[model samples]
Each structure stands twice: as C-alpha cells, then as structure tokens.
Target: MHLYFLMIFFAALPAWFLSTLEGWITVDCTRAAVSSPMECTVGERFAFSSRNTRYATWKARSASLHRHDRRGSSVSYQLVLSTASGEVPVLRSSTGSDKIERIARDLNAAIGAGSTRFSAEAPPDSLFWFASFLVFLFAGVGALIALVGKRSGKS
Candidate 1:
C-alpha cells in the first residue's frame, strides 16, 4: 500500500511541474504580457520586459500544423508574433487549428496594426511536448504500479 502511494505521488510530480507553466497571455496595442505560475520561466513573467513596451505593429503568424506520425498521430498548432527581431510563440494547441487561428486573428485585430502570415516552418514545441509526454508516461506507470501492487497484495 505504501509503495502504491509512493508511486502515485511520483506520477503526480510531472503534472505539478506542468501546472507551473499554466498562465495567461495578455496583448494590447501598447504591450503584451505573459503571466505564469510565479513567472519562473523566461518569457513567462513579461512578454515584452524592458526591451520595448510598445511595438510599431503586431503581426500574427502560424507555423504549419505538425503531424507527429511517430507519436500516435498527434497534431500540433502554433501561433507566434512576428517581430523585428524574430518570431515569438504565443500559443500552442494540440486539439484544433481553428481555435488557435481565431485567437491569432483576434490578437492581430486587437493590436490594430495587424497582419496574418502562414509559414511552413513549425515553432519549437519539442520541450512542451516532451514535458507533456513525461507527465502522461509517469501518470500511466504510476497507475499501473498501483494496480499491480493492489492485486499482488490481495493474492
């Protein structure tokens, strides 16, 4: 029983870590801000930190939907901002492309000086997906262990 509990706790660890990344992005004509749990990661606390609060214009760009053929047919969509420096990813979704596109449209429209662009390049989302996979794997293993332990104890 104790081992089962320990495994369950370990499984929840990844989910807890991922939860830290959950936050909101607020964008307006004046500024764009990213707020996450404790603002621990880069670009999490503030999207436009001391560099420049105001942008001349905001352009919305989407990378081609990536179909991970090897990863159980998972498809991911990314939305990014095209800045003078480079493209900054704002949102990533694995559920649907339409929602992300609509969000990009809204964001660009909100900024007033907005444009839309689609690119063949995909945004870097390997880290996010890797973390997500870890969470899933850990949780699944934990559950399996718990189940097996329970059965063995009964036997």
Candidate 2:
C-alpha cells in the first residue's frame, strides 16, 4: 500500500521542482535588482536592447536550473549587427562602446535605474539535491513494497 502511494506521489515531483526553481530565482534575482523576469541560460545565445539604443546578444555556456524550458529566467548576450538585406555579417563589433559598449551602457543604466541590473546568474546545486532525495526515497519505497509482497505471498 505504501509503495503504491509512493509511486503515485512521484507524479507531483515536477510541480514541486518547478516551484522550487522559481523560488530559487526569486530570492537571488531580487537581490540583484533585475527587472520583472527574463529567461536565461549559460551557453545559449540571447539578444536584448539596452536603453532602447541598440540590440545585443550573448551566449550562455553554463546553466544551473537543470531543466530547459522554451526559455529561462534571464540571460546575457553580446551585440551583433544586421543589415537591411539581412544577409551575412553586415557589421560586427565586440564589447566596445562605438556600438556594443554604448548599447551595453544604456542597458546597464536602465537596468540599474531601479536598483535592478540585467545580468545572467547561474542556479545553485540545491535544486539537484532535492531531485536526488526524491529518487532515493522512491527507491527505498519500491524496495519496501517488494519486501511486503514477498512476505504476504509466503503467508
């Protein structure tokens, strides 16, 4: 009976983890004063405009939330220039103000305006520990269920 119940409870695990993921970000994001929310990944490429001046993109090489949704909480990307034709590289510059740095500064200002900054932060490992605990709990329950089944059969 208990083992069966344990198996069913596993179904709720996803919801639990999702809540935890949001809460985890909420605490840290608030600390950093970032805007409402933006999906971010460590290595994935992301694009955004700063101070409404220019658009930039950054690649996320690291991620910590453990799961990938259609998007993440917040991410960073470098700037890329596109042309009217939208063909190959119309123009490109890296991390400098001429275009990229100016944009970055504008964005940084807007974000910093309300004590919030647009930056990508990786999730910590506590999330994984919860997952591991859930797995182990179920394994123990399964073993218990088998033990009971064997004993009842003998009786």
Candidate 3:
C-alpha cells in the first residue's frame, strides 16, 4: 500500500505542481528602460533596480535576455536586462559601427515583437515537484494502510 502511495505521489504530485506553477523567465537586454541602478556582467548574475523613485518602491517592470551578433565585425554580446519605473538600462551593444547597427536592428526587432521587456522572477524550484510528490505518496500510502487495518479489525 505504501509503495502504491509512493508511486502515486511520484506521479500525481507533479501534476499539482505543474498546474500551480507559472513558468516565467526574466530576460532584460536594454538598460535605458530601467528605472533603477542596473548591475551587469558577462557570466555573472546581478540585481537590476529601477530608477523610478529612490525611496518609492518600483515593482519589476520588464526584462529581456538576448544576443546581438554582427556578421562582418565578429562582435556579439549576450545581455540580460530589466527595467522598472521607465528606466531603460543600456548594455554594451557593439564592437564598432556595424556592430552598433546590428544591435540597433536587433533591439528594433524586439520592440516589434510586442514583448520588448520582461519581468524578473526568482529561479524555479525544481524540487517543488519532488517535494509535492513525496507528500502525496506518503499520505496516500498511510491512508490505504489505515483503511486496510480498520477493515481487518486491527487498530
């Protein structure tokens, strides 16, 4: 019975989790749209705040993660950026003139996509599914065992 429960938890718990979770990723590429002081690096994760108001809190407004590539210049940069309160954080967009143009074109495309900015959210907890599965499995097994014992006149 417990084994059955464990299997159920392993299988059914993920469904509950999938239903409950809203999957979203923050991908900020431009800084000028941000309202807060922005922090950035190539291979590092940093916090980006909006410049909306120094004291007043501004919720995470938008974010974008994108790569700008230039064919002739051999220049490309991957950027993740966000903005709030209308501050647009700027990222390095070019190695030279052509690169700049390429970057601009890419940004323009992002704008046309109608989702130029993104909202930042915490990383998804993968273990959420595991935990939920375990909970369901254990509870189901325990309940089944209890039911069987009750029918057999065993407390």
> Which candidate number has the best lDDT?
1
TM-scores for every candidate against the unseen true structure: 0.40, 0.28, 0.28
Taken over the whole model, the C-alpha lDDT of each candidate is 0.47, 0.35, 0.37
lDDT of 1 by residue, 1-155 (tens): 66656566766777665554422333334333321111111122211121123333346654656566655665555556666666666542332333456556665554453223221212223444555678778867877877888788998
**Where does model 1 exceed 4 Å of error?**
1-57, 68-74, 91-97, 113-155
How many angstroms is residue 42 displaced in model 2 relative to the true structure, after the best TM-score fit?
3.0
Candidate 1 vs 2: which has more TM-score: 1
RMSD of 2: 15.1
lDDT (10s digit) by residue, model 2, range 12-122:
564354333311111111223243431221121112111112222221111112334678543322433222333222112111112233433443444445544344322
Candidate 1 clashes between residue pairs 3 or more apart in a chain or in different chains = none
Which has the higher lDDT value, candidate number 2 or candidate number 3? 3
lDDT of candidate model 3 versus the reference = 0.37
